[model samples]
Target chain A: MKRRDLIKGAGAGLLAAGTGIAAPAIAKGVKQWRMQMTWRANSPLLATGPQLVADYINKASNGRLELKLYAAGDLVSPFQVLDAVADGTLHMGHGYPAYWAGKLAAVQFFAPIPFGFTSQEQNAWFHYGGGQELADEVYGELGVKFLPSGNTSVQAAGWYNKELNSIESFKGLKIRSGGLGAKVLTEIGGVPVQMPLGEVPQGLQSGAIDGADFVGPFNDMAFGLHKVAKHYYWPGWMEPSAVLDCFINKEAWDSLDKDLQEIVKGANAMANQMVLSEFVTKNAQAVKIMKEEHKVDFRLLDPATLGHLGRVSQSVIDDVGQTDDLTRKVYASYRKFIDTVQPYSELSEMAFMNARAQLKS
Target chain B: MKRRDLIKGAGAGLLAAGTGIAAPAIAKGVKQWRMQMTWRANSPLLATGPQLVADYINKASNGRLELKLYAAGDLVSPFQVLDAVADGTLHMGHGYPAYWAGKLAAVQFFAPIPFGFTSQEQNAWFHYGGGQELADEVYGELGVKFLPSGNTSVQAAGWYNKELNSIESFKGLKIRSGGLGAKVLTEIGGVPVQMPLGEVPQGLQSGAIDGADFVGPFNDMAFGLHKVAKHYYWPGWMEPSAVLDCFINKEAWDSLDKDLQEIVKGANAMANQMVLSEFVTKNAQAVKIMKEEHKVDFRLLDPATLGHLGRVSQSVIDDVGQTDDLTRKVYASYRKFIDTVQPYSELSEMAFMNARAQLKS
Candidate 1:
């Protein structure tokens, strides 16, 4: 049956809830499902994650549930992962929800708020700390169900043509960035330009932007961003922990038999890990070459700039808190979870770094 | 100041004859080194990969290269990535050599090795894939360094207490899986499984694992395997995508001059992707609902076990020929690189899991 039919069948829940029925209707006789990925054909994580999921489902269902993954440009633009699935144009798709910050501001926080929780803590909040409920409330309104798809650790500050040492250096700097980090940069007097990944290189070269913050080394190098900028900075403050999502059309989601549902959850989890791991490997090597071999200047995004960015981020968060009920609820859950987890993490890494800095050489 | 000094200091390599010139030692005045992680602390990848590197160097350098993680473990694991270090270890550590299996491996492959490349081929073939000649080779071998940290994705066919149907029944056995299509299972016998997040409970309690496989989901699931298993399988043939490493001892790794080394290469290239990605997130979810979820009956082994786990896995390639040579070469590079990466990792995860898995899930 068509993917849309599966979603309609699951919609029985709406009617059941309205009628006060005890159970929702189950979509039966589903043969195959498709998931479109936002990454390119050869992206290690993008390619491998879906491949693993397809393999798992095919084996589990004994060949009944086939998952076909269409890479970016095959089914839709990389940026359209949310809409295609939410509108029931596709069964599922993989991407970072923060990409759709305009549609829902809270979506950005769910993925990565500047100086947000790390991957582990974020997962904790989502799975155990009440973050998922808040996310569902927001996504439910969007007609999609999102599962953590992957993570990209703390990212680099971005490629820069000039060194940045203080908060003043950031003022009026035209930069290519997106998601909530863009909002924070704007607050700090830097101009944030949002552009698709494919368009980044050209943006930097033509002077449409001074620099761009994309994923780390491998991806940046692959796009030849180094040729356009020399000073590469560290710590992607905007996306301290950029999280990706596996968006499934809610209607299509509710139709599967119980066992099938678990498979999807398990598959997404596996995909999340696989993709992240790959990014780390490729990015690390690329960064090494970019610096030592290629002569790229590597530096931190100056502590002053960092501090200012932090303050700006907080203000943006406060603004979001006052804008909508959904944002407020999610913000509260997010803030509570972050506060609880940060202490332990800070003690382990943050505290260690502070003390290490004082060590006598 | 050359990359070779970094490799020698890390003690990860044996310079080719006539290439043993000792470079000048550390000139002095090094600041703290920031290492990006592809793993979260709780995930197996995180447990075994980065933390070990950090702990080792913190003590060895006497606090010279004070390493700090930008994300993962706490900030980003599997998702938060993009290493910008110089050298190996955190400069490089943990990633999947097999991820480039597409560009690296010719066949339509993404998963590690179902009967394809061994850790040896996956690693060895990399040397032949022009990858070895590329910066990756020097980086993979003498320049950086790495090791095989953990292997959780070598998974199990999930837990179930019922008998599976004919191949057609395979069509109906809702399973949770990912990656390579279950073409082999379909070739043999069974259905496919794919579904959403909410229905796993009723599925498993109702006899889902009747044959479902999701890596070692038991670690993360709240339910115990005994609650749903009538059988437990082995050698996760489908996965074959095992993990290995690329790591450098911090002091030895960081000894090179500031400008010439990037820890992001070699060990980190492979480790970042494979090390934590495989087990980081999966472990937690494996046992999320063991007891509350279902009643499992542990099955010893399936009858077709030996049939599927055939001669090929151990010694199918008598010589591996050109293919085998390439595999051997890549594995050899991995072996040499891991020599440097493994020592510290062993003290961390091996010590913990060997004890922990015994205590609980």
Candidate 2:
């Protein structure tokens, strides 16, 4: 199957070529690799990362390298995204960086820290700023090379069972949060539970946790979050911009031809955008359904509680710094960067908000 | 047209309501004016912005307030989002401050001054660094109140027609570029043409322009730039991190019920992630098409030319500074910001590239 032949087939052939199955055989007479994503087939980001890259490389090299993708749970469990990619069981995995934080503290920053950067800023940091370097350094230590695969802008706080009238309401409440947000929540007196996506609905139903936080309305609705937790909270300050990753085995990545490497990067970039746009269009319908059809009560954490959480977030960062040297380096860099820009944000964004609120009221 | 009737009809109705047709009818009996957006239909940021005050006023008045979403491109072009909302064209427009650089010199800095600041650092600037004050002063002049809607990550440079080999190739070339990049390209002796999304392909096809630049692969592919141009470029240095906005008409926004304002802001927050993620996923396939079918050439501009362009860019900025106070203020701020963090970018990003290229050869 020549590269042109594989491409001509389109659809399933495109899929097959993308995941690396018969692509190399049919295309450029090169090598093929397969990656089974942890997200559902409907997930544009998860389904297409490898596919897009494979197609690009196949086309670029006239079929020298191909990658085939398998939907979530097809080749491995969803939770295995990072592990599969890390151990070379899979060539790559598309998931959040924080999922691998246990392996490296710096991974969490790649995704989101409490009250961290938004998606746009994070991308700038990683791509143009010193972010990708830091990311590469951290992940390189573990024999994995990371590509930023997805970025979810400021997210909703989470789904709640009731309104948060004050900071005290957080005490004793059990909620599911990820990355370093769990630590922030814990600091604010809430009990934090970390669970995989598959377990969320069950957790909510069985009362294992009081509430949960996921990507946003599109995913939340797709996962039927509104069905379980009726009160959706807002201002996901803890995870303002959630970034996902495409973790490829370093050896496997380096082994690819130059064209193949470019393809992989190109494909990841495509997947990142698709996921972002789909959510933009689809989430609206989903949220509307949840609000009107299902009667979900959406709420924002009280201002006081939000402020308290922000303070707690600072302590959490400090705590992480105390616990790990790598964490200290990343956090220190982040802190210094934050401090330099703090005055600007205060005068520009904060002042406007304060002035507007008073004048409007 | 009633809120109940609209909600009962669902998605399409909400979309229609967003165009302002249904808001009046719905406002008759609604105690709570809630707005949904395509960005994030019912998120909390909406409530915090104009909608929050709208809700308050509606509540105070006992059911006369109706808040609804101003979906992307609902009342006007998405690019004109901020202006529409600010000038009371509609109660709100999804404000992407990054897009308004043409109007105000300083707006770019407030958004993300190309290759500057990570998302976290941006938030720091807006919240604590006095950036917010500067941004508000700008927006205040425009008769609008602004809040962080959401942010995007670093974007790709753009799709191009041919691989650039040397600085000479830029001379007499007409290409599609925008914002500060137009100036940068102009400095390099190239003619930079600005065209909205609809006009790019025609410009490319008619040779009205040699190439064009836009969001990233996700968006570029959607427009099928791969089909028109054979070369795709990278390192979206011009718009390292573009920020989207949720614009509100000062007077009308101020008049909105409180909860409704928060709804708008919250939805913008939600939109932020959706847009970011969409770009990530979509670009993969677009680039694939470009590589495979279009046989698009992927090349980075030669370092000498890139360096030359960078130098010219400074001159352009300097020239802008000589013309207007706002331009000078913005340039000074931007220059100071860039100078402060450039050492890090140099040591990390540029240095790594230099080291890696040596290793590559």
Candidate 3:
């Protein structure tokens, strides 16, 4: 093979193995950039979002822009993706905005919060209700450009070894969880342990953690959590839905021509919706599989428990949203949007779901 | 200005007036196609979806593909879009599948059915649950290619003259509705009336039609339905959600290069999600506006009424699905998808929405 052909072939092979080594050929004005996702290695479901954007950008641009994709820790630590993209070491990074909440409290609203926006509502806010602009304002300070890139629509609450029949069922219980949800758990006298998601199944099996929240049925089943836990709970109060963050280094983004820029923008929007469709489809299948095959006992958190959790969550969100100026502004917008949309949502989406349920029951 | 520039300028002016005249310049491999939408003129919400796709395609292609778009009655009658696109008189067309169900019964499932798939569920089915393949198979017979282009999300049951408190309230009621929903309405002892959307307000004011079921609050308020009707009802059981159709003439599509083809696919996908976001945000705003300014009374159909409607809807959909072999196959796929997703949707979407309403109340 010719030297150039061999180099291109090796680059493609290494890229497939998640290696960041892309001595990428840049001939004939074809641009190349490295992109990495926060999703763990070889996760087909979560990685689908980033891959769709990368593939679309490449195909739609007719090979003008090539994005070399990597999974978490393949190029940099998942926790370091923000800083890497901000510093221009990485051209583009994909993850949830909630990961950066420590740097900007407003990020939580963009990602997930207890009983926060569902997939459709959160997406409406971003694309139509001024959310993308607010997000741009917040992320601009960090030298990053933001796009809503992916979604894990409405998760299951978690899996528990025991049925959570009442509010008191949470007291003295241990679960593997993190972020804002951990604080809410603490408030109810539940112990939130810090454990790797990879360790969750073993933790539950060994009685180290009595419960765990990964994603919905799709990812949970992938981790074999249902095999160890008896009760799968509902309403995913801690994370009703999550939108993945696509961050590009500001300097790198500014260098792209208008054609490539629009391709990236349009491709990311397509990815945003595609990811939700994937999750909803896969999660449903997992729920059915776990129910019929594994005999997993599914349960719902009772009204009293949900009500208590709701009150505590509101207080928590309010307290956190008051931390800084951006958070304050973002929270105001977020709060106003919810207040504006909730009544209609209650009548439309919620009412329809309830009616469907009533008919089925 | 040059002669070419003058022609281009005149074309732009005429196109802005919704004229189909594009005597479009196709110099330098720049492809130009006339596209028409079924949305009414000056209706911002519905038009936004098609406009987004056109703009994205033009910009992303960098003027290679100039999609000059027209509204209903501009280039052809709304009823003629499918025939236009199929026989190659019109290069492209955009509208709801329900509009063409008279030609092919399976089209209704892709558009709307009483107690049918909500926006998210419908999208998931199309993109992930084999609905799109079935759609392509059905539409391919008509010598056209199809894409899921837009969504209305979950609509309000629509405007009413009075509160519908029970199943009996629908008896003897006169409502302006169409398609499978109208069939279910007739089954429930309601008289379904035929009327143009432009005349609905006057008709409602004169009690010619007691109520009208239009596209949710966004389009409903645009037609001033809230002014003539005192009560708004919801769960939108008759038309839970509606997805718009983007169809291309088969020969025109086959002639496109791969890059332009991918752009079309990605742009349509983006359009599908954008319409939903636009509708959701605008519908919420309209609900707020009518509630405060017009004092519109919002009501919901009770459980028993919804149940009766649900049963009738099933029978209606079943009968239609049995009309042909393709529809029966399509219906089987849709039914299987609904069964796979509904249980999980109940737990996550419904339970979360219920918990949210409980908190707010």
lDDT of 1: 0.52
TM-score of each: 0.50, 0.48, 0.93
The parts of candidate 3 lying over 4 Å away from their true place are: A1-25, B1-25
Which structure among the candidates has the greatest DockQ? 3
Q: Write the per-residue lDDT of candidate 2 for residues A1-361, one digit (tens) a residue.
A: 3743443354345334444322235544576666656677657434544455445444533345556666666556777766666666667766667767887766666767776564544664564346677788888876778777755555677877766788777888888887688887777788988787778887887789888877777677777787787687776766666676777888788876553564466556545544444433344445566766888776656555666667677777777766677766776766655543332222222222222122212
DockQ for every prediction shown: 0.02, 0.02, 0.78
Best by lDDT: 3
CAPRI tier of model 2: incorrect
**Residue lDDT tens for model 3, B1-361:** 4844654564456446643323346687888887788886557778887788888888889889998787777656788988877876567888888788888777777778788898899889988999889898888888789898888888778778877888788899899999888998898899999888788899899999887888888788887887788888888988777988899888889888888998988889889888888889999999899889988888878888889888889888889888788889998999999999999899888899889889976
Return whichever of 1 and 3 wins on TM-score: 3
Q: True contacts preserved, each candidate?
A: 0.00, 0.00, 0.82
lDDT of 2 by residue, B231-279 (tens): 7665554555566655556766666555344334434443444444334
Candidate 1, fnat value?
Answer: 0.00
Residue range A230-250, candidate 3, lDDT tens digits: 899998999887888898888
Candidate 1 CAPRI category:
incorrect
